[model samples]
Target: MHYAFDADQETFRRELATFAQKVLAPHYQPDDRAGRMRPELPREMASMGLTGLRVPERFGGQEADAVTTGLAAEEVSRADINACYILLVAALNADILVGNASEEQLARWLPPIADGSALSALVLTEPEHGSDAANLSLRAQPDGAGWRLTGEKTSISMGMLADTGIVFARTGGSGARGVSAFYVDLHDDRISRTALDDHGGRAIGRASLHFDSVPVGRDELIGQEGAGFVSVMQGFDYSRAVIGLMCVGIAEAALDDALDYARTREAFGGPIGRNQGVAFPLVEQATRLAGARHICYEALWRKDQGLDHTVAANMAKWFAPKTAGEVVHQALLTFGHAGWGSDSPQGQRLRDVMAFEIADGTAQVAKLVVARHLLGRKFAP
Candidate 1:
């Protein structure tokens, strides 16, 4: 049971952190204020080989393992939480393309995705259904050897400006087995998007995507008909673990800020950190963050090893964001009055961490996944 990153992984982490500090940190404030990514950011990420970490190297991706991917996500989050969305969405879409796309399709999409010439999103959640994904009501009907889709997907990361996306829709019967995935171009006139006023991760632009009879060619279909749900759910097992790492990274950043305050800020006579009261909460949060980080990497390691890590993945997802929120809150309080100001990024960091509590899967939904695995599906809520 190794607990540390390999020499290679650690080297990569340092490199990515340096890259993020130089590229992502400078734009964080302006992008957050604008509620969308800077136009040049994606191209920058691609030039650095940061966009398609999971795609095969032959197609220009790093072909990274789960652990490497998690490391990259953590380093990126530490710079700007919103920028991490670019990596996460790209990973999800890459999983779909790698597992189900035709060789020709892979050749066409992988390079642009790897190079950041194309921005992408994984579109699954709709206005009516989120965790209950099996029952999504998006309709994908037959149209002369192709498909025409019409539905509304809300709160989608990068929806307001993605160049492409992998959209899930119902094609056969009802429930999970009926779902199919398609690669769709976001520029189509039939597709319209509206940005949502979200509390955090504003630069990512959570938006509602309206597909009005959007045409999808037969070549765009991913995997066999009625098999899309299986592919996507499998991909989640990989992503949920990485999400845990991303949350931990943001919390760690907040902790770093608090530590600086504790050591330098004066109270009574000496630094406030000299007192137990100001330092204990930070200590507790630090401990929790360490544990969460270990769990996140453990799950990711299992993924790289091709082990069945379902329980570990769910446990990481269920606990990491919840802990991150608590830890960031403690950091905010430690900052005293300074943290409350809109000028300080602490408040924004807290809001951004809160989004993860509901993003991939809510804490309760993650618990249900774990329960169903351990106690059997019949006994799960």
Candidate 2:
């Protein structure tokens, strides 16, 4: 099977890598320190069409395929991990809106996101329901022709700053079947936000959203009343693979630094890389990350070809970030105390990669999915 990128994809990769280094890398640390996204970043990314890579052409987007979108995710995260979340969260939410929203709803919301006039975030995980999203307690009660939503969602990326967001709330009975999705304006008076000072990926700004009496009309409800869980859960299969690529990018960056240091730094009249002890672990990590990258792209390619990719996606999700964390740790140790300093991005890379281990789904949860898919759910965990 062909493994290399096509000519156009290669060109896209080179250009995006240059853009990330020249633009994103410079502001990454400052923005992280400030715990906020740069005000101009969203519009800048939109100008590059990065924000709407997966959005449809009718909505002013390039309508990139899943493989291309995954490639862009890897390059972007390689330069600045936190900024990658903007693309990830937006693309997932855009897909949801495209797939489920009515024609008028898509017309209204898609343009703003496509043109970079607005930023979007997904509101799913609540304090009480991290992995148990199907049982989220957020309440949306019918009020005449609309619904009034009231609940708190925590650990949401870009929750405090998104101009718009998609929220899942309970509208029927209990569990997954009762959940429904709503499109809401973050600026509504009934909505209040509090940003969290996370250890890493601070620019993405995880936050808690308290929605009290937020009014949404019937038009705001996406798809049928209880189909929202299925809609969003389907998106996760794609997102998990993309997240794997993102982590691989971070790990590659860290390993590159360590390799550079090993080749140049001398100890006892020789370069440290000359020692197998210093070099073998790096070799192992390189091998692991390469496999992870292949699986991630393979999963995306399968998705583009309308093939079943659940097993590949979950495998990548389970392995990539875990490998990334291990590689980054080794890289830090290879730096020989230089990596421990706050001045070194290696530490930040470590903290950032740690989030992916739990973000989209934990390794345990991902394994469970793979297990269930391989064996029938009746016999699987």
Candidate 3:
């Protein structure tokens, strides 16, 4: 029945909001201009425990719940949406590691991430297989007791900067069952990276990762071979909610800026806030953002409660980013000429938010998931 953050949660939210504005926001534009990730960004995030939101405390992590993880992502994203990709990918990988990794494996793998010595990327999408990830063509040839992965993964978030990644590859026959996941060392000389000339989210270091016979020890195999795709898919459901909140945060930031401008900027005789045409659209955007944000939080809440949240998460995945794109574009228009310039973060926000509509899961793919959930697997697409 309660519809607000508890006292501790509110405090945490405020702390993160301050940290983000003071530490992260300043670099948001600078990093974009440089077209690269700031080396210090991950270290600063780790100091705040943003990098370890889902990791176990015993392993030097905060061990935060899904709702809190989503909350952290939202607050951090308000200052820098591209930076939130680090949070999203790390959280998703952490959950996977926590659920499927053995104690020894956890000991070996997690502390570095918690302490921010290592950055993680999800090596799932391929040049030929994006949404069709089940049919990924990456080859994992058995070599001695381990495997050697060889293929290309394109449009990977943080691919260029990550010291390690969970690389999915085919180990058996064709289709999803043949696939296996490995938490491999990405820093190996066998792997070559090519950074994408991105239009948006430039700081995320999206790139194409080419694995050239990179060796993976048997110990690095995540869970059982052929079980990788299913495990990753399950972890991804919760991350969709996190991605939704990320969209909400950026759009909310844009709307606040536009509102401030509307109140202060004089037009004709007085403030533009006087005009219904200008005021109403902002009103509608705010309302839409609120609704989308609520669904996102609700999905994460369901996750924390151990309830099936696929439907809500998928819905949030589809709606929030799409709503954010519309909202940011509208907010940009509200800024008049000021929003059009390179100096304006509004345009950057628009481009960054557009990536969400395609990354993780595309809007169309998310709709299909919700459709299956609502219409029954037998009836749905």
Candidate 4:
């Protein structure tokens, strides 16, 4: 397997990094402090053909593969983790809708998504079901000519701001096989949203959605009925890789900031970095960051090549976010009081990376996936 990126991918990465540095990094601090979404950023991303990285060129996307998408995500996230979150949701939503939506549905949804005129949110996790998404309790009952949905979804990223939502609800009897995916317009009269007052990741605008008998037509069904759970799971198989890469980017940023501070910050007649206590943790951060990057890249590579990467993806998802959290914490500690200051970049980095541990999938859930894969059904509970 080729471990190195091709020239085109490298060029794409460099361009993305340059764009982030110029456009995102400068505004991230101010926008985040105000808890505001960068409205102009999405338009810029679409103009650069980033919103639809994985969608077919016919659908106005670049049609890049998994590895390219992961690389782009890493660079975008390194600049502003919140933007990366938005990009991932857009890319993953496009991937799912394009892969599963009917021709008419695609005609209706894909162009808007590709052009960045609209944003989509994945509503899989319910108020009760998170990692256990298959156990969804949201009910979608058959109505006169369509269906009516009633449920509450919590912690939905971009939910408050999205124009459309890919919602999963139960249509059949019970269990995962009964669940169906529907593309519901968020503007419907029966739907309402409340933004969560979260401590971290506030820039991404996580929210709870309340759907009270929201009407949906047959065209809203993505793929087949009872296949929503599997479709979402398949989507996660790739999205989690992107999430892992995001963690890597956050950690890389933290490490870079810490190393820069170490070189300039003086203590005991010299830079504190001269002392092993401060230097050693930085060393460990570098080592872990390298490992997480390798795992994430390898997982993405395997995906692009059509290889089975459930195990590698889960391992990366589990390890990368946890490693990023550790590295960011270490970076904060390296700065001492400066890191604790609200105005400090390291302080913001710490909060941003903390969200990675929970987004997409929590660290605990990722470990369980890895354990289940390695041990089969014999794995302990």
Which number leads on TM-score?
A: 3
For candidate 2, the TM-score is 0.98
Clashing residue pairs for model 2: none
Residues 1-381 of candidate 2: C-alpha lDDT, one tens digit per residue: 888888988999899999998999888778877778898888878877888887899988879888988999899988998888888887888888888998888989888887788889889999999888899999998999989999999998888789998899999999999999999898998999998878788888788999998999998999999998998988899989999989999899999999999999999999999999999999999998999999999999999999999899999999999999999999999999788998888988999999999998899989989989878798664
Candidate 2: Cα lDDT at 70: 91
Candidate 4 residues lying further than 4 Å off, grouped into runs, are none
lDDT of each: 0.89, 0.90, 0.92, 0.85
What is candidate 2's local distance difference test score? 0.90
Full-model lDDT, candidate 3: 0.92
lDDT of 4 by residue, 270-365 (tens): 998899999998998899889998888788888888898887888888888888889989988888899898887777777877787788888788
Which candidate do you rate higher for TM-score, 2 or 4? Answer: 2
The sequence of per-residue lDDT tens digits that candidate 3 reaches over residues 1-381 is: 888887878899999999999999999899999888888888899999988999999999999988889889899999999888888888999999999989999999999988888999999999999998999999999999999999999998988889989889999999999999999989899999998898899888689999899989889999999988998899889999999999999998999999999999999999998999999999999999999999999999999889999999999999999999999999999999999998999999998999998998899999989989888888664
| Candidate 3: regions farther than 4 A off | none
What is the RMSD, in Å, between candidate 3 and the native fold over all Cα?
0.9
The list of candidate 2 runs beyond 4 A from truth reads none
Give stretches of model 1 more than 4 Å off. none
Q: If scored against the real structure, what TM-score would every candidate get? A: 0.98, 0.98, 0.98, 0.97
For each candidate in turn, give its C-alpha RMSD to the true structure in angstroms. Answer: 1.1, 1.0, 0.9, 1.3
Q: Is candidate 1 or candidate 3 better by lDDT?
A: 3
Clashes of each: 0, 0, 0, 0
